[model samples]
Target: MTTATMSKPSVGFEKLSMRGVTRSYAKAAAPALSHLDLELARGEFVALLGPSGCGKSTALACMAGLQPLTSGSIWRDDVRLDTLPPEKRGFGMVFQNYALFPHMSVQKNVEFGLSMRRVPKAQRHERALRALKMVQLEEHAGKLPSQLSGGQQQRVAIARALAIDPEIVLMDEPLSNLDAALRIEMRTEIKRLYQERGLTVLYVTHDQEEALSLATRLVVLRKGVLEQTGTPQEVYTNPASAYVAGFMGYRNLFPAKVENTGPGDDISVVAHGTVLHGTSRAASGTANGAAVSVAIRPEDLVVAGQSTGNSIKAMAEVVEYHGRELSVQARTGPDTVLHLKTNEPVVAGAVLHLGVVPDRVLVYPADDGEETVQPHV
Candidate 1:
């Protein structure tokens, strides 16, 4: 029956789960989370990514046993986590603010967790030194958090988390407080640390690029619902829905109306008061007489002087030159504007030709997230 017991525990015993969990605030219109089902493999990093109010951080709190789940359960490995207290959950957390004690030296901060648990004093000091070395901050062990740069403080926070040798690590937008360059640098640093330790991490962030870069499995959520979950490439290359598609880098979405179905099935869309064709399969079987939206990514757009597969004549409205590439914003006939990222340059207002590969397009039901049409099976 696989009754959630006596199962093998992977490294650090880091399995994580949320089953039918819900959270509601009395004054809010809806639950902060609804029937959420999330799973993280013992050693894999799963990123909880979404916009504000989307239940990502809430889910993390539930798993950490910091906040009570309104319903259902949370678990780590084969044990029910909601049954335990925050400390009993065997979780280590690093917040966005790098919550370290201002008065404590780096070594003391890292040893605090172990000290709380009554670890042998000698062992605690040894583990703390090792944790500081892991983050390359052993030399700063004598300095306080106030004396460190933002990045260094964050690293100390990481060292503190690692000192406990926790069953799992939960990070909530830990790099959000850093500047752009530091953020990029820390992203690589954290990736390396996680890999070296084989740590299971559940990270929460609203940064699409960050999730795309770090997650072994990325979960995209919206308005308290799970939109999609997949490997970064799979989520980006083949989104499960429009909401998820947008998060995966699609920027040029056009409203489409499905008109027919067959080998020569004709879908219809209006641009500049003119009807355009070239849609592949109607997303929904009922799309024949229904409305839908088609998504085309900026990189998938082809710019030139003639029409091609699912091509549209977009008046080059604006152009911005980025170092290695050009950014193009064009009005495709008037109703919609399409954005393209290209290495090539073309004059603005040139009415250049642009085409989207049918296979690369993502179609969504017009009503917006109420329904999803999976690609033909």
Candidate 2:
């Protein structure tokens, strides 16, 4: 079914803002969410990304009214939304699990919310069918959730959320239950829905790649604190901190001391008794002798040919075939390991010279309190 024919939800809003949103559990040392200030403009797709227990899910729950905030407020334009009940918030939520009734047919599951609101039978049925059609699940409307494949069940869950005609869709790891292939397919489907319907989405997930692929903007969290907010490209290419760099797939992190500050955010650092040059991500560039963490992604670390720019001489420890490229883990120091991808066939124990461009190496202050010298697998 074409999106043009599908029913549009009344989701337009100037902004939905979360101001100083904080949630805490009893006996917990820290709040699940801490002074999180976030905003969603009309039709914005924002992904809440972090590791487990980082409170990405908690943030979504607080916004959805499933969890009451310990402090702060939620606003939908001029209206204060935190005081309202979940049903009155006009937000639809898709869960990590399908969350469908085993005994109910797909159509019935989709119509449940409308029925609770006392919509007339015929109108609710029509809306249910339209929502099902939006997810391309109209043909399975009569089948029970138990009789469907995992992907089909997830589609039904999505249809159920849409049937409510919500002002915003709150999804908490909606595709985590599916297989890798299904997750990719559903990611595309969700992206299409957001674009075609101009959806206001607040999605939560721990997978950086999933968030990067689907979100227009990303909100990264660490230990329940909002770490950074930016476009996917901004967060991926230039992470704000060492913690963010680690999460964004910087497999190699080195403890370095600033050697000299060069022109235009370029600086040299002494890491493992070797001088390496990189771009400083810190707002105020590092000074000489200041401790810092240097981060580089595996793909950015290439086999050195001749130029001698930021080159590291290492012995390959492990080599894994990845079809088009090889994944190599190499040891550069007594306790330092670096991971890199290369097209060249590298044998274990082979000596290799790996180099990285200055722009690709990100430098963050070690005092960020999250620096790790070890390679991240």
What range of 10 consecutive residues in model 1 has the weakest lDDT sum? 1-10
TM-score of 1: 0.85
Q: How do the predictions measure up, each by TM-score? A: 0.85, 0.91
Query: Which residue pairs does candidate 1 place in steric collision?
Result: none
The residue-by-residue lDDT of candidate 1 on 225-316, one tens digit each, is 89889998888787776767666677765566665544543455543334455444334454465677777778888876576646777788
**Cα lDDT tens digits for candidate 2, 172-208:** 9888777778678778878887887678999998888
lDDT of 1 at 321: 90
Candidate 1, backbone clash total? 0
Off by over 4 Å in 1: 1-14, 120-126, 133-139, 263-283, 333-335, 369-377
Global lDDT for candidate 2? 0.86
Instruction: Name every residue pair that clashes in candidate 2.
Output: none
Evaluated at residue 299, the lDDT of candidate 1 is: 87
Task: Give candidate 1's error at residue 46 in angstroms.
Answer: 1.1
